[model samples]
Target: MRYAQVFYISIYLLAVSFKDVLCIVDPVSLSIGAGVGLGALYGFNFMKDQTYCRVTECCNERSIPGNIGNLRDMLQKRLYGQHIVKQQLISALEAHFNPRISSRKPLVMSFHGTPGTGKNFVAEMIAEALYEKGTKSRFVHKYMGRLDFSVEKNVHIYNQRIYRDVVEGITECPRSLFIFDEVDKMPPGVFESLASLVDYNALPNKLDGSKAIFIFLSNLAGVQISDQLAKMLKNGELRENIKLSAFEQILEKASYNLDGGLKKAGLIEQHVIDHYIPFLPLEKKHVYQCTSAEFMKWERYPHKQVIEAMLQEVITYDRAHGLFSTSGCKTIEKKVATEVWIEKQSV
Candidate 1:
């Protein structure tokens, strides 16, 4: 409603400026009418071509590996804080549409987490689940990392439109899950355009009155730092009585560990920590520590047994070479050494 009013006012101003040249009369009425007309057109056009699923389930049942129950279970177990997160996501999607039995609603979900924390895998599992639910929906999208861009050419090679198309493709399916993997990779220049899709009023998707929920999976940790840290730095210093907590180091390391080693080179000012949303460092295990076995298995399979044998070898290596901590050895185990040993063997 506010946007419509603003739109008309802008039109009126432009009309008034050119009124003498164009010889227009009743410019205010014309502008107001046009604004309403456009808004109605946008809404009606969206409704006329609006897409919906013919069934409550996806079409490709045989080809999709898992069932809805399995997918739900996987989501519950794998995604930490599963119950509330799942409900919140579902409710958010549901609010956009009517409660119908037919499955044609397109679901767009964004999952955000740290690097190597299984964002892609979770997407795949969700796709498989939606497929089993009897919708023709599949995990049709893919990863587009920084390497995809051509810096010298200066060409804006973007995949967001491609992702948008993938969602549009499943209009006939019951529940389509369009997963934009590593969404944070969308270039800084294109962020505003992307933001439009997320913002309710500015949505570029006027078509289909899309029942599809847009899932944007990102590493929230990354977003939080990039969006926040700097503004908090202007303050003088931490108070003498206040303690400098480990949360500062965690944010610092997280920023540093991002791709391209850019974050690693950047320094976090102490004043920012003192003034901003500072608290305790998360005492959680590192991603690599939790998924060491998974990484090792993915790397070499049965040879992983032999690699497991190298736990002592690598701990000794770390301690002797000052490569890592003795305590870190417990978390990394032989899996870490196996990764290095395998690389050496390959070389």
Candidate 2:
């Protein structure tokens, strides 16, 4: 009885208090008009939400990968021969997104590897896995040194442009991703100004920058990586057992001790980078696996003989002492397409 009285009393108050709607517009309908108008507004908001792409504090699960599973599957099935990359990259992403774990700054990582060794490929995979539109997303920024930073002499210009774009991007969307390809080609200090922005500091509007992600790709330590890989292979150790420590020499060399290295630019000195992932040189077998994956991508079964024939024309072991693909799996897709065309014609 008392609950009924309270509920009725609250309804009465609401009905009376909505004078703006009751008295101004529908003076005659006081009891139910307030509710009618309010309910209409609620319906409008619901419809608006359905129609518009509103960004909430959290990412839209429909657009972004809900967990690390998507990335894990993509890497496991697609990225061959780089077990370390698959393991560490997934782990790093998990920790970064885990609320239980606290990161002081944006998740900054540098990819060091030999050319065609899947550095850019891994970066592309990350973008595709993380963003709804992959590399086409407005929130994902990819910069090539030769093109974006063409005027290397004007390093300051590049810095300002980067700063402006990153700040604008962060303001527009906190979950933005920045990829700088061929970091070695850029002037060492090209990104020095961004160090503070990527650190554990409040952004321009007091926004937390920790949700952002930055990836740097380069072949800076290719030689050192290859040398360590060779040593590991020579010692009969599983390449998967090679730890990040194995690439310490490469890091040291690229870490700014020498001029023109990114470390000299402040990322390493300021402790912004979270990891230096090394993409080991792919063996002939790994290349074969890459070729098979490419064939499957084209909806063709990868017969061993067919793939070897395709590789014979384009495979150039003339470089890197025949240890790895001349260009990793970079050109595998094109080569496969050509072979498929020729084979189809012959058939």
Candidate 3:
């Protein structure tokens, strides 16, 4: 519209100048000026339309290639101690990419766990696997629930913003991925606003987000999840025997019982989500595995004494019911890096 207005003004100015010169020129010259003015107007309009079309096509056509096998391999390599997470994620991707499925709703997934349990890490890995730029891809957007919905009264405003952002993002890239972190802190209304977008029904808003992915990460069901794990451990059960399906109902119930964003939004009641994958708490061994991986990534030679000493300094374990990293493996990398630097300085 703005360009059209500019083109019209330019044409009008040219006509006025041509008319003024007509009085001082011959009939042939006047005809020539009129012809030249029409040609310029036509050229300008053609350029305007072509430029607009090119810009729109570019925005709508940008997409990244995705591979299921590569994604699975990347998730396995980068994320440790979350075997169920990797398997479930692979399953979800397979179903999402199934050629026979005709659902209009986006692939909605919820990641439940305690802090530092690789919820966010796995989310990033998915993004990285699907796109070459990974989390840095323009199509991959990460939003924090706390920051996005900090104001209670202005939730409606935030909801509109969220909807607009998602729609606009999908419009630009149909294969876009949206990640909501700290979902436990999000308001219920915010998720409600997005329910329609995540539903299986075709969107009346004409936004085709079927190819997009929406991942919700929260610690809402962390305690219940951990309690379930603790009980299994108490019974002398191995971690490998802890299947996700066995306690899915318990996790769902716990999520609904909580006052967190998912419960408030009635996501559980609506069953809008396709998967509710739980991230188990990191054991002391898992933390050690994370530390060892970080040490290798940093090219630090693993010294048993130094590693054990560093673990003691960085890890806070419970004595009563065996050892678990309360912070999960969140701080292990930095702690390991610092320890390695100290060891180098000492040498």
lDDT for each residue of candidate 1 in 113-232, tens digit (9 for 90 to 100): 334334555556655554543233443444454544223233234435543554365444423344444434543332223333333332344434243444444453533432232223
Across residues 1-347, which tens digit of lDDT does each residue of candidate 3 receive? 56855665676677667655764688787778777667766765566446553442222322255677888887777677788898788988888878798766789898998888999888887877777677887889899987877666777897788778888888777788999998778766776668876677545467688989999898977877777888888899898877889568877787677766776465667788888899988887788778888999988777777678777877776444455677888988788777778878999
| Ranking of models by lDDT | 3, 2, 1
Candidate achieving the largest TM-score: 2
Q: Which 10 residues in a row give candidate 3 its minimum summed lDDT?
A: 54-63
Question: Which of the two, 1 or 2, has more lDDT?
Answer: 2
Clashing pairs in 2: 256-264
Off by over 4 Å in 1: 1-69, 76-109, 133-139, 147-160, 163-174, 191-206, 220-347
Off by over 4 Å in 3: 1-63, 318-320
Q: Can you write out model 2's per-residue Cα lDDT over 81-143, one digit (the tens) per residue?
A: 898798789988888888888776789988888777888888888878887777787778999
In terms of lDDT, which candidate is strongest? 3
Better of 2 and 3 by TM-score: 2
